[model samples]
Structures are given as structure tokens and as C-alpha cells.
Target: MFKKAFFAGIPVAILCLGLLTGSCQSTGTNKRDKEGFTAIFDGKTLQGWEGDPTYWRVEEGALVGEITPTTLLKTNSFIIWKGGTPADFEFKGSFRITTDGNTGINYRSEQLTDIPFALKGYQADIDGKIRYTGQNYEERGRTTLAYRGEKVTVNTQQNAADPESFRANVKNNAWQARQVTGSLGSSDSLQTFIKSNDWNDFHLIIKGNRLLHYVNGKLMSDVTDNDTVNRKMQGLLGVQVHVGPPMKVQYRNLRIKQL
Candidate 1:
């Protein structure tokens, strides 16, 4: 009777062992798709993401972010990711503006938080004047207002500098696609560009600290890692809803492919 009982339980033991080993590895990581890529946003919900829930929404099949009056979405503080090392790859998504201007997104972030990072890293920008498109700030990044001495000048040429340039490019608030390919260099230096009206694609290749920002298939910002100390950038991927009039925006088809 004892021998018969032990033999009968063999199949059950094998199944249990398989279940335990399978779950352990996938719990902290994502499997690559058949296209040899792994998707970040699931397209329907904010799974594998944690942050100020008030900052984002999943509405009518779109991943949305907005700025509420008297509210700091702090969407620019963290990224929702599958468990894995921050991989260097191409990030692409479709977006539409629905607010009172001033909006941007961050990439190649090292972590998540509200503290200023000095000469630590860089953020790829998204500027839609009616929705805060191309304005890059050193939010806990290397550049601080207090540290800007007497003759320091802020660079605002990345996203047309003003609304007129933004309005002239967008057509009746249409949906536009944007992309950033972060290719780091051996040194950890970086730079990025933007595209708004057109279905523009920017390729960012980061090989270590070295980075590049290509806009609408053009080289816009070619900067390197300068140990000069600019805090507020780099650390975690985040979306920014500037302190301004209330606004809303929609995004979809978000995908990431490691290179």
C-alpha cells in the first residue's frame, strides 16, 4: 500500500515543482514578444505602475495625464515598468493635447522621486504649447535656479520657445506620434530633441553616457555628458504637468524595444 501511494503522487510532485520555478522568474520580469520586444504600457491599464493615481488615467482606451488646479500631478517623478534593468531602446507613442499648454515627458531616468539630480542625467522632452510640449526644466536635475549665478542663461530653444510656433505646427488638435531612442555612450552623457504636429520620430541612441536626440529625422540636439552638475534630470522616467491652468492629454500605442 505504501509503495502504490508514493508512485501515484509522482505526477503531482512534478506539476507542483514546475509551477514554483515558473512563477519565481516571471514575477520580476517580462517576457519578450514574438517581435523580439517587450511592451511597457499594457494599452488598457496602469499595470506594473505605482505613483500618484491622481496624476494619470486610463480613459476610453487611452493612457492620459493631466494637471489639475491646485494639484501637482508629479507624473514627472516615476515610470511604470516591468521588472528588469533599465534597457537602452526605442520608446514610441501617440499623443494628443487637451489642456492649457505646458507638457513634457522624461526618459532614461535612473530612478523615481522629487529630489534634484546634479549632472546626473538628462530627460527627452515633449512640448505641445497648448499642453506644455517642448519645455525642459532641471526638476531636481543639474540646473537649479538658486545656482544660476548672475549671468547664467536658460536654454529654451528646444521646443520652438513659444506658443505661436507650437500652434502653427498643430492642426485643430490632431493626434500625433512621437518617439525617442535613447542610445547611451561609454561615458553616460546625453541629449534629446522633439516633434509635435507631424508624426515625427526621434531616435535617441545612448551608449553609456553619450546620447543623441533626433527630431523628425533630423539631428536637433547633440550634447554630451558634462560633469558640470545639473540636478533635476535623470533618475526615473516621468511625465510633467507644469503648475498652470488645468489641462488633459491622451496617449496610446506605447511600446519599448531594447537595442
Candidate 2:
């Protein structure tokens, strides 16, 4: 009976679809999405990375950065990847953070001369709380370039000031030379898509003056830096452990595809 056989296969087809849904949600990106990307982390060791030994380590197949009360940091620190600088690229990684933890991925960034393992450049902001997550923050640079759900273009200033001075100016006036061109969604509404106290997928697509940050397949922030004086074309890549309460963050399956 052809009709009876087709109907019997329905339950099996539904079971296979359910299994796939769980797999994709658990890992964020599926195997097909990672086809061209190469894994930077080996899932077993910190082989090609450099950071303060006191804070970073490889644990449970992930690159882990933890700050204990006794080992709290006065300044933010980073674990830099010793790979080639990628100018135009797509990076995908999965991260999990503690309730109070703050961390980010820095690309097209420069390591500071005075502070070891310190970087200054555009950062894909991530925090245990979803408040600042999915934002584009220029750490030790222009500060907040674009908050979640914002699409902006940063214009150049006549006098290119240092990061500290720019921060001071923002504190006084809460202003920068950035113009909000569009909106992706409300910041509060976007948070509903992010998982709490669990692993989340983060993707950064950087090309020329444009940068995009996505979380769990949702585009959260988009920024275009028209300021040639302060923008970086290419530089180092690193992950940070912020200067705050004792906290922990882990990154796994770091893969990149250079465009």
C-alpha cells in the first residue's frame, strides 16, 4: 500500500528534523556555515596564543579566562591570537560568560606599548548580562561606536584626540561625532534572543570601513567608520577579560575566513 507506507514515514521525518534543530541551537552555527572557516583554537591547548599566565588557560576544550578575587585585575587584559592580521574577514565563535563577567573580541586592534596584553581598537562587546552585549565598542579608543540595534557612521573630528580625551569629552556632553543612520531593533527587544548563562554564537564580519556584529544569527549592531584618521585597516586579534569583579568567560570553536 503506497499510501500507508508514505504516512508511516512521517514520524521518522519529524524526528530527524527535531534532532537537527537541537544541534543547530546548541552550537549556534552548523557545519555548513563553517565550511570555509579554519579553526584558530585546537580545542585542547593554548598553542598559538599569548596572555598573562595568571588569568588565561585552556579548559574543557575552550579558551578560558577567569579572574579570582585574589587575582583581580586593575586593568583589562587580553589573550591575543598569534595568527596573521586579517583585513577583510568573517569570524565566528561561541562564548559563555558568568553573571558578572565582561569580555569582547578585538579586531583591527593594536597592542599597547605600556600595558602588556592590552589592546586598543574596535571590539565586539560581550557581557554576562545582555545589556552591553551585541554592541560595537572601541576599547581604549572611541568608546561606544554603536549600541545594539543601532546603525551608525562615525565621522572624523578636526583634531584627533587620544582615547582618554575622547572619553572625557563624552562624559561631559555624552556626545561623539557619530550619526545614527538607522535602527535594527530596540536594545531591550534584542536581548530576548540571547541566552542567559549559556553559550551563545557571535559572528563578526569586517570589511573596509564597515563592521557588523551578530549574535545567535541576529544582527545586533552595524557601524561604518568614515573617520579615516582614527580607523584601522588591519591589525591584531584578541579576546579580553575586563577589569571588574572576579568573573569568568570562555570562548570555543574560534574560526575565521578571510575575505
Candidate 3:
């Protein structure tokens, strides 16, 4: 299932810590207001990461992901934040989505083969506008574990009904929280909040055998890493440009930690 090779996945998951939206967030275990941590992005330019900044851009002070109507941006570049790879890495941060549609971030991935998940690993569940806030569902693969309220049904095809009812719960055009974490090939896990045209904070934790998804600073989804997820491929991360609704989503304060 070998297809293409992404850029040389970078190492040193840099830390972009500071006051976001004037909340004075001391991210990182040491705290952003503390010491011994390094800054990954300066919030001015894309210096360390290398790739087609076509779909991704620096707007105002956030990493805005734009998809021009008819055009979509998909890259084959390994854009590293600091440089190098981390054996036990944990990526955490928040994104402010402006549009209310489908979009996502891909990580621990490699080349896309004919069968899909070629070098594919795990995808944090960001679909289903009908679910509650900050839910992590597996896409394109088997789900180790998940939760669906009795009122909600997860069909055999994994489809849901009354999605509009669920969509109504969204805060609309605001900042939410999201997170995804996992090791490259041999481990994977992801998490995200329900769809909202707003900003959300996320923290994804991934180790050798465990993957956790946290939304809105709450541990919403959690599961153990499996052999099915730990296959081949070690590619860089990518933000999605969905195919409907002429939508727009912005991701900012993206930071990853190496364990």
C-alpha cells in the first residue's frame, strides 16, 4: 500500500505558548508563564514548517485554513514545526472555526495508497454534526471504542439521523477546543468537539499503546492503541479543505509535545 512519501517529518514538536484571546493560558506542563519551554511559532510567519502554504496562511494572528471555492490544497510535504520526529509525542492546541461544515487535521500518516490508509494511521473524529460537543470518532478505519447516547443510534454503516438537531447545539461562529495525539506507525488516537462555527480548544494525547481525545479541556474520548492502527507510514500533519458549504475554518495556537 505504498503510494507517496510526505516531506521529511520534522522533529522537536515546538511549543507555541502565550496569551491567546487574552486568556493568559500557561500551556505545557511547565506552564506558558514559566520557563524551560521553547516557542515553536512566532505567529508572524511560517519559518520552521516547510510545505505549500497554499491552503494554510497567517491571518491577523491565527493560522487560517482557506479553501478557494473551486480549488483544494492537498500537499505531499513533511512540514515540521521545529524539526525532527518524536518517539512519544503529544500534540495539543485550540482552533477557532469560522465556518460550520466538515474539516479536519491528519497526523501520524504517511503516503496514501490505493486502498486508502496506505500509510494511514488514526483520524480524530470531526464529522457528524448531530453529536454532542467535542466527540472523537474514527474515520476510514475500525473504532476501538466509542459512545452514542441511547437517543442516538450508530447504524451499521456508522451513519446518524437528526443531525440538524445536534447541529443546533453548536455555539456558532466561535472558538472551541480540540486535540489529537499518537505515535507514528504502531500507535494512534484522536479527539475533537462537535461541529460549531466557533473556536475550540483541543488536547490529543498519544503514547505507545494509548490514545486519548480531549475537547473543551474535557477528556471526552479515550481508548487503547491497537495493532490495526500501528501499521506503516510516518507522515506530517495536514489541515483539511472540505468540499461543501463554501466554508472557512481557522486553526491557531497549535503546539505538540514529545514524550
Give the best candidate by TM-score: 2
- Please provide, for model 1 over 1-259, each residue's C-alpha lDDT reduced to its tens digit, 9 standing for 90 to 100: 0011110111121222222222321212244456434345556666644444555667877667666676544333333332333335555556666525454445555553333211123554555542222222234343221110111223323343245553443333310111222322211121122334333344444444344444345443343343222222223344444445677666665554555
TM-scores, all models, native as reference: 0.53, 0.84, 0.56
Ranking by TM-score: 2, 3, 1
lDDT of 3 by residue, 203-238 (tens): 767665455666676565554433332222233454
Instruction: Give the TM-score comparing model 1 with the true structure, all chains together.
Output: 0.53
What lDDT would each prediction earn against the true structure?
A: 0.40, 0.81, 0.43
lDDT of 2 at 34: 35
- Distance from true position, residue 15, model 1, in Å? 20
lDDT of 1 at 139: 43
Best by lDDT: 2
Clashing residue pairs, candidate 2?
A: none
Once fitted onto the true fold, the runs of candidate 3 whose alpha carbons sit more than 4 angstroms away are 1-38, 72-82, 113-119, 127-195, 228-235
